[model samples]
Target: MSIWWSLHLRREAASVPLARRLLLGTMETAGVDPDISFDLSVALSEACANAVEHGGDERAGVSSSAEYRVTAYLDGETCRIEVTDSGPGFPVVRGRRGALRSVHSTAEDGRGLGLIEQLADHVHYRNRPGRGAVVSFDKILKWREGALLKVS
Candidate 1:
């Protein structure tokens, strides 16, 4: 069976943990491997932190009512999560391979994207310029029993 959920949260520090806990509970209830759940939970925290820090009205100094969104989808074999924010989009950077790179190890900030990329099997970022930014990632899920059996 496939499981999915979505949450619309205020852009605040407290909201980050709330999202993580919900994800954790979902995975645990679904019998997802602990290691996989931990990794995804950490990555989810990072994504939420980025949205709280960079994707909010605080940067613009106009609206105190800022919020973010988190969505998760879990099939029998794969888990996908998306975190979106209603603030200025992320800055664009290109890696040596000409791919969009949002992380800078040399810098003191913006390390979450790097960590997210390392943890997830697939990572994608979408920026709506003046509207918002979205960070989406997916990871292969494993059951404690054995390899995931394909439904079909």
Candidate 2:
């Protein structure tokens, strides 16, 4: 079975937990391995936190009601999530292989992206043309032996 859900949340601290809880509940109901679910949930929380903190485009006269979109998809043996915001898109700097961005140990911010990369099997950071930033990630899922929503 496949499941999909989306939420339009105001860019606020409280919304972070709301999104994370929904994801955890969904994964729990689907019998995802506890460790795997926990990892994904952490990654999701980081993404949501980033959006809530930097998702506002005030320079562009965007509304005070800053908002972001969180979408989750569970299909087959994988789970994917995407968080999009309406802030000014981040710059793109490519390294030899891909964007070479490093977060320092003393950094108070920017650690979330690195944490997300570590937690998820695959992670993507990009900007929506003429819109804002998008952080999308996915992980290969491991289910409990008696998973209630096992996919064929």
Candidate 3:
């Protein structure tokens, strides 16, 4: 059974907790491991927070976006989450291995993204071409005994 959900939310601070609660509720109902649930929820919150804070701005005398999007998918043994915003997009940076590296600054914001890296199995950061930035991540799921996704 695959579970998926999406939210188009106003870019407000309150939206962070709202997204987190929904993800947590879904995780609980699916009997996901508490630790994993916590990690995912934290990651979701950080992504949402970034969207709320930096997802939009007054550019070229234009008004900023009032909203952003969050999506989640749970299939088989993996759970994927994405937060997309209409902000300027991620700063371009490459690591020694030629992979996109998270912001490596002392700012708290950078740490939040770095935290997401520490918690998730795989993550993708990209832009939507015409005008948006997307931060998508996934984790390997571990089910509790009575998990809805559990196979006997």
- Which 10 residues in a row give candidate 1 its minimum summed lDDT? 143-152
Could you give the candidate ranking by TM-score, starting with the highest? Answer: 3, 2, 1
How does candidate 1 fare on TM-score?
0.88
lDDT of 3 by residue, 102-138 (tens): 8866865678788898899998898765477899999
Per-prediction CA RMSD (Å): 2.6, 1.9, 1.9
What are the per-model numbers of colliding residue pairs?
Answer: 0, 0, 0
Per-residue error for 71 in candidate 2, Å, reads 0.3
Task: Please give the TM-score that candidate 3 achieves against the real structure.
Answer: 0.91
Candidate 2 lDDT by residue in tens digits, 34-94 = 9999999999999999999888788867574388999999988999999999987666666
Better of 2 and 3 by TM-score: 3
Clashes of 1: 0
**Candidate 3 Cα outliers beyond 4 Å, as residue runs:** 60-64, 97-99
Best candidate according to TM-score: 3
Q: Sort the predicted structures by lDDT, highest score first.
A: 2, 3, 1
lDDT values, one for every candidate: 0.86, 0.88, 0.88
